[model samples]
Target: MIIVGEEWEELAAALSQADAPQRVYVVGATNSGKTTLCRYLADETATHTRTAYVDCDTGQSRIGPPTTEGMVVHSRPPDPPGRAYLRFVGSTSPGGHFLQTLTGAKRLVEKAAELSAGATIIDSPGLVFGGVGVEFQFQMIDLLRPTQIVALQHGRELERLLANFARHPEVAVRRIPVSPAAVARTVTERRRYREERFTAYFADGLSQEIPLRGLGLQGRVPDLKDPHGVERRLVSFNDPENFALALGIVEEIHPRRRALTVFAPPFDPAAVASVRFGSLYLDLDADPGSMESSRP
Candidate 1:
């Protein structure tokens, strides 16, 4: 069960006061009850009208696996929500893949709008400090242009970023103290959570050889000179429109055959028009590995 305090009631009332479409963006530092608040808001809104919950927190995504922005539409209470529409960001963090992260978020949020959702609640990643963090958050807010922003902070941590939006007439910013019950997670616990998500995502995966001839390659394209370099690397198979069909791991790359052997959950290989390689390499048995590379 989600735990929310009385502070959320005001936010709920504000949301309820609006009859027009509401796009609420939830922002906070790590373990600041952003997700819990999002859950509460989504559920409350869904009870009245169609609501869309957009999970932009690629690291600890609730609607989809890590490294992808996920969205789910609910016409009623989301007790057991339907499958999420996913857009792969190609990284667990947005620090290096800013373009991909922002693009994915915009795409999912737009999709929610197209679905005619009365309320779209966005949950963001905990990247809200430092030069890169501040810039990324600012760009995201500018790009999404949410009708309301719910900032949950321990102190003035988010003021540096939220201050920029204070005077924006189109957007309303609500600041709430970080819940006293919010508990920080250890690094080890976070790693284990990602591992579990990756493991579960590929649990029913099968190895298939997908020809690379007509496919558009993206992200860290494997060097043909280093055939085994792509092994164990996470990748996403996208359709003609570049929407992710599913995620896979490069099991093998046959240079001569001009094909890639990928282990992924059941999906139509015929529908894959592009293969976007990710920086992460998953070894199910240990911590995920990363390869530094330029954004796709």
Candidate 2:
């Protein structure tokens, strides 16, 4: 029977007594550092145990190609004490990208279970696209029941994700809030750079140049829409108002999630990357020649 509820501790105890390893699912938006964090966590757990890393970002796989031409059980090496990093890449490239990633993730999960991995960490793709993303999240939760799920969010995407995951019984969700210290550092650094650069540049006087072509010369055929002209006039970034307006456009097209949280600070890529699973270390207390390793 499957274990469930606030029995995370019980689950851990059961797994510890059991031979197989625990499994975790790492998910977040693109560029949210899900892969980097998973690598570090897996490597850390590798010592005194075997760990596997699975990449489900099939649309843009970070590790290797998707496992094809084999059943889930046959995907890993036919040997003991072996670590397999699973990934899925659609060779055909048909269907929507999110759909591909979701399907790939299901396969990865099945493979992880089959391998009886001591622990498996799965890194997933960004959740921004509409229906596909929702389907992906639900399917993953239903299949994995990950002991833990680490979600990364940047920009305005977090609210949407929070609202969706809030209803899930299996998820132990936490928000990694943007750090106050980081904000302070950003402001200070920007202020220093502003003082050093803005003074001299703005002192010399600045103005934007917009070019206009005469319709008479081009012979306006009553009414004609110029693709090149519209492309050239695409949104400008230098203006804050324009940037805000662009965000509004996105929000309109894709509604934001309804909930929010202020938990841990945003993940620090450098710190997370620095976390090594296995490295040169003398386990003087116990086993010798046992080195720990993990990804950056």
Candidate 3:
């Protein structure tokens, strides 16, 4: 069962008020129960009108798979999580790509807005600890211009980060309490979660030979022409608009035929408009080596 604290109850009440937030930006430090709070708020909002959630937490993500910023609309209360629209960030963590993260968030928010949901909740990454984390939060707040800023601070650690919004009278800044039942995940658990997600995503296990000449390629290490360059390397297949269609793992890079033998879930070859070589090399059939950084 989910633990709902009194403070969470208060936040939910405020969110349910007639004049409550429409575009709610949920932010918090790592392991501060941000996702839990967002889920609660979404459930509450769904009681009244259509609720849309844009899940931006690539790691430990619920709405979308890892390394993706995704959106889902809750037309009714207690809507089960599903991937509606997604943009790939190429990494589980947003350490190296703040701009990309921000861009993807903005695009997803725009998509959410178009849906005209009564309540739009944005679930952000818990990267609110360092310089990059601070900047990412700042840029997200500035770009989204959300109606309310729901920050889940464990303590004063998030003060400096929330300083900018402190003076914004128009923006309702909510300081909610983190649930006591919130448990911090160990490093081993996180890795296992990623591996499990990857395994489940490619469970159907597709093996297709994709011609390299048609799709645009990104990243450096795995040159499509190089023999065995992209073998076992994770990749994101994109549509023409650059939205991620599916995740893939390279089985073999057929240099002679100018094609990639990749294992991806069922997808149309014509729709595979672009390809990006990621740093993570996950081999469910084999060992996903000790170091699986998302930088190719």
Candidate 4:
């Protein structure tokens, strides 16, 4: 069960006030109660306005699987963890793919707004430790321009970010204590979580081939000079409008035939317009090895 102190009630009442927020951005360090608080607010906020929750944490996501920033629009409170409109970030980490992380978030937030959502709650990743994390979040706050920022802090650890927002009076900031129930996961557990999601996502995955003549390729191009590492890397297939359709694992790349074989979900081949590859490679069917070594 998720439990919080007086800070939780205060934030809830503030949000449920007469003028409901159009956008709320939740920020916190690792193992903080960011996701739990978001879940509660997504339900409570829906009492006042049509609600939408944007899952931006690629490592531990509730709206969609990992490696994607997803949106869930709801008329009432969200339940059973509904289906999400997702945009693949190509990688799980934000430092390497800062553009992808923020771009996907900006696009999905706009998409949710287009659906007539009155309130969009964004749940962010727990990466507020170093210089890269600080800069990345600073840019995200600038991009989202949220009506309020509900920051969960273990103590004074997130004081820098809160102080940064204090300089901008337009952005209201609410600081709260993290719930004791929030669990801190180890690195191995994180990888295992991704593996479980990948297995479930590709449960019925089939190996298919798409001719590379017209479909534009993106992300790291397998190092054309090396070409040694190609198999098992995740690739995102997007439509003409840049909406992600499905994720596939590279099986083989045929330079001669200008095509690539991939084991992925059964999406309409004709709809495939662009391909984006992820930096990390995976062998989901095999044993768990060091994921860092798998990246080239």
Candidate 5:
């Protein structure tokens, strides 16, 4: 889906003059072979012009670590001149669930607006459930402004996205069907592997790829003591509530006998909290001297 920004009309006029390569944005769920399709397209068109695949799937991103936390061009200089991959790693900030994740996509649009080169292929993030994921797609379209968008379908998600895309005139959305034969082969292989590798007791309610320890069941199964009830608690620790308890057990069994110098540095709690949470964003356009206090 495309949403041309301020200079889109001018850019379209410019593309009409020269041999501007068609920019394509392929969007789909995880493991839907978006990358595979991009690579195939690139290879097919490689002999004539240039091709590049911008991987924007963060968290489980496959493209070698991103150039910048936001968005940056990534391609070796000797390989091709006018072509490069625009890899965008969403946000790394803790609990950054909303617009923060679309930071990379924002940068991508800005860069795409500036380019006058060959085809720019963008592989976007999966529309994972709720509103945040759905809105992120709109943000991407606003950024990349791809002439064409290919959405791979697995369920009703693709239809929903298409309905949203129709509301905007700038984008031309299309649907392509994945081969059922290929999907059937994958399922068969997985079932075969699971039957041979794991025992019946452990394989239930789990994928064949899931490891025994990775289940978080420890050794024995958990009991449903409060199946109907619910409880909530918070601690300084991250995931898995029994982290502190496990650390206490470790200390008792094999304690490290070393004195530590823990000097608490003097810092304003309000300032520290602001910095930690990044509540105040630095204004890049502002005078450097005026913004010095906000920097490290």
Candidate 6:
């Protein structure tokens, strides 16, 4: 049911001949088949050895819910991919949370390396234009130090950005046309997709109260003086090491009691050492809203 163009086939063949432990960073605009290409490459590379698929596209995430970078290690062919590691970025789009996005991607990529994956394929978000987008891509490429970059663009849309890395001897860049099968999605559809993902993630969630006394907070911390400001805000319950254990939706903030009521899937509250707040607010029964921007 997936379409693989000749260019992708050639790229795969070329990669097969290269050295082991390949770090491939894939970039493309929205609906340009970035995920599809990463999936195909992971499957192809897994046949030889363990392959890691790093999902940096937080908006349209594949391994975990939106606003989190996730990684899956494929040990063999036909491996049913699951979230092996997750890092919270706090926003669906990487616009305002550039540092979080870059940091999460780096951590996940490092995790993939730690697993000794033969090939690590990173799928980046489709924010390849504008000042922020260009800078983000540049920072990510410099930080991750990918062995190769597969740029899928319509015409010369990415030429300006790719120009910066053209002479980088350490990284090889490949430009390919967007797949013919790629379909552009409307804003409404993208929002709906995110809503569906959030809804499914919390389908069986139960309300639990978390004490804020010893909990470290990250990202956009809510105003404790105004309890309603944190209502329905998306958040992540992180382990001691700061890795996300599970996501939660703030149902209520008990400022006086120094506790938070969150609706999240079953998770050990004791394991949560910190609470990372996101800019997005979701009611589950209604469309999500962003405190950072109008996105999603």
What's the lDDT for all of these models? 0.84, 0.38, 0.78, 0.79, 0.39, 0.85
Task: Tell me the deviation in Å of residue 277 in model 5.
Answer: 11
Clash totals for all models, in order? Answer: 0, 13, 1, 0, 1, 0
lDDT of 1 by residue, 51-163 (tens): 89999988888877888889998887545665578888888888778999899889989989998988899998899889788889899999999999889988899999998
> Ten consecutive residues with minimal summed lDDT in candidate 3?
287-296
lDDT of 2 by residue, 1-296 (tens): 22222333333344345464566666666555565565555544554345567666533343432211111221222334343333222221213444434554666566666666577667665554576665667566556677655555555555554576676775556544322222222434433432333223223332232222321111111112322221111111112111000100000111133111111112222221111011111111223222111111
- Which portions of model 6 miss their true places by more than 4 Å? 78-83, 287-296
lDDT of 6 by residue, 81-174 (tens): 5456888888889988889988888988888888888789999989988887888888888999999999998898888788988999888999
Tens-place lDDT digits, model 4, residues 124-172: 8888877777777888888988888888887887777667788686788
Residues 59-121, candidate 3: write the lDDT tens digits: 787866788888888776455644488787777888776777788899888877777777788
Superposed by TM-score, candidate 3 places the C-alpha of residue 36 at a distance from the truth, in angstroms, of 0.9
Residue 129, model 5: lDDT of 48
Candidate 2 deviant stretches above 4 angstroms: 1-21, 66-100, 129-131, 167-169, 177-296
> Looking at candidate 6, what is the lDDT of residue 6?
91
Query: What's the distance in Å from true for residue 43, model 5?
Result: 2.7
| Deviating ranges (above 4 Å) for candidate 1 | 78-82, 287-296
Worst 10 residues of 2 by lDDT: 242-251
lDDT of 5 by residue, 1-296 (tens): 22223332333333334365666678776556665665545444444444445556543343322111222232333454343222222122212434534554555544544553355667676564466656667666666677777776666676655676676666667666543322322534533332332122122321111112222322111122421211110001112321111000001111133111111122222221100011112222234323212122
Q: What clash count does candidate 4 reach?
A: 0
For each candidate, what TM-score against the reference? Answer: 0.93, 0.43, 0.89, 0.91, 0.46, 0.93
lDDT score of residue 290 within candidate 4: 48
Error of 3 at 291 (Å): 8.4
Among all windows of 10 consecutive residues in model 1, the one with the lowest summed lDDT is: 287-296
Over 4 Å off, model 4: 18-21, 77-83, 223-227, 289-293
Residue 247, candidate 2: C-alpha displacement in angstroms? 40
